[model samples]
Target: MTWLPLLAAGPALAATTSRPWGVLCVGLLAAVLGAVLGIRDGVPGHELAIVLSALVAVTLASGLASALRVRRERVLAAVRSVAEAAQHALLKPVPATVGPFQVAVRYSAADAEARIGGDLYALVPTPYGVRLIVGDVRGKGLPAVGTAALVLGVFREAAYDEPDLLDVVGRIERSLARNLGPDDFVTAVVAGYPGAGRMEVVNCGHAPPLMVRDSHVMAVAPTHPTPPLGLRALTGETPSLQTLPFTDGDQLLLYTDGVTEARNHEREFYPLAERVARHMSDEPSRTLAALHDELLAYVGGRLHDDAALLLLRKPAAVGSAPAAESRASVGEPTRPSLLQ
Candidate 1:
């Protein structure tokens, strides 16, 4: 029947990714085929012309649908481009080394399609020393992204201007309290190297960072508990800075819940400490690369939430210049606390 050809053309054109004209041509050919079949079946000349005319109409409709699909795809591409640019500006990439530390960073937004999300990480060399931060917002999508951006912007500015690490955290807390929703909060670990062999960390309701020294791994849990950034009012307690010995060949790993909370098919959370102990190395970059690969495999190649990992190592030669200075042309890939 003439209707059968129209039905077939509709689906074929709907699935085609080629130019609309190509699909239009296919629809036309189908219509002509139907007409040839009608003539062979001895249909009247006037009726055969009507059948061909109907096919032409079907072809035109198919072309219009194809055009709409292409237009939508172009619009989405433009949107993605804008999102990527925003990500670059907000999450400025870290150099391989800063001051006395060798560093590496690996970040993955749970939505692979999006270039940025709620997870945030940063590292900057300041007059005080090198400061860094890694944090995660409470929710997902655009609102979460906005909060993460705000936290990072304040952290960067305060890290440079305020000599006190606690002051840096105070600035972020004030900003979030002013701008964030009542229920919004961010869990973060802010740390800095005030001197060549000393490091200070302030934990804000975040996962405890892992310390690796001489092939051993241990959690750097703070002795005092502190609320996440936006809820400091509820607890009425400020975060305390924990100082540690960060000598040559020692590394510190800072991560969000995404790293430890990722589940496998069995619904078991990945054992980050045990795994890091197995893959620990003097090189921060190589260690993180291995960890990220294993994490993806554990989650079946897709993450459900934004993930961020930052590794900072005190080189054996502490006073010497960072290796990255010579490789400044190469891109390498933060925390608040003033440990004076």
Candidate 2:
């Protein structure tokens, strides 16, 4: 009689890792064993019946629980699949090389299950030159994701249509003004690599981009302070275009606040410029990968906010190449050309 009570544990334990049918089999075995033990103990008929009844009840309940658990897991799997599809659609993957620059990107969402958050980046070859934007939307979750999608959509279209870098920023500002709430705003840095070895950067109240020159890393602060994307009306300040020389062997890194603000157990912020100098490499991908790994380790495994890093390195010209105009026709597209 004492041993018969332990039988209920078998079905309960099996429910965790087995199907309903498996739980039923475990319960059946347990019930048969319990009956034999009760008979051998010469327990009274009424007590034996009570013990058997309890065991049977536990089995049925465990089986139902197992079925419910499996169903919930399937539903979760389907939700994860849809989230992945949405991530790919919203944040299209960037190729290793875009135009003449070697490009690399690393992104992490605070919500591990979401796969994407408010951080956004886009790099595409335009008729003007290779252009890119790195920005962070206010807040998190689905609203933040929606704002990110809106910003990227406007940037991709404006990058090809607008000749001037500032014009591209204007287009985004106007679009956001119409859509975003009063307090919602996005901080962004829009950049273009036109001819003349000069890169045009428009800072819209975001983190200054870091430029690596001759093994040195320096922040490219905005010439004029400006409000974020949706706050032009409140501040009445406009973003200014700062042009910097981008020559061979030069690299530029644009990242969101999540990277810089990440803290360790000691609460020390990650030193991005120093790490970038330390991890400098000919390949942009390798550089970002090292930084990404270090960032994760610094935060003790997971980030609490959305983080994004985009690195662009201009390699030395190999030899004589076709004219910019000729290459423009082949590279210029509405969407970035995915590398094979």
**Highest-scoring model, TM-score:** 2
Alpha-carbon TM-score of each model against the true structure: 0.87, 0.91
Using lDDT, give the best candidate's number: 2
Q: Against the true structure, candidate 2 has what lDDT?
A: 0.88
Global lDDT scores for all candidate models? 0.83, 0.88
Model 2 residue runs over 4 Å out of place are 319-340
Residue-by-residue lDDT tens digits, candidate 2, 120-199: 99998999999999999999999999999999999999999999999999999999999999999999999999976778
Count of backbone collisions within predicted model 1: 11
TM-score of 2: 0.91
* Models, CA RMSD each: 6.9, 7.1
Model 2: colliding residue pairs: none
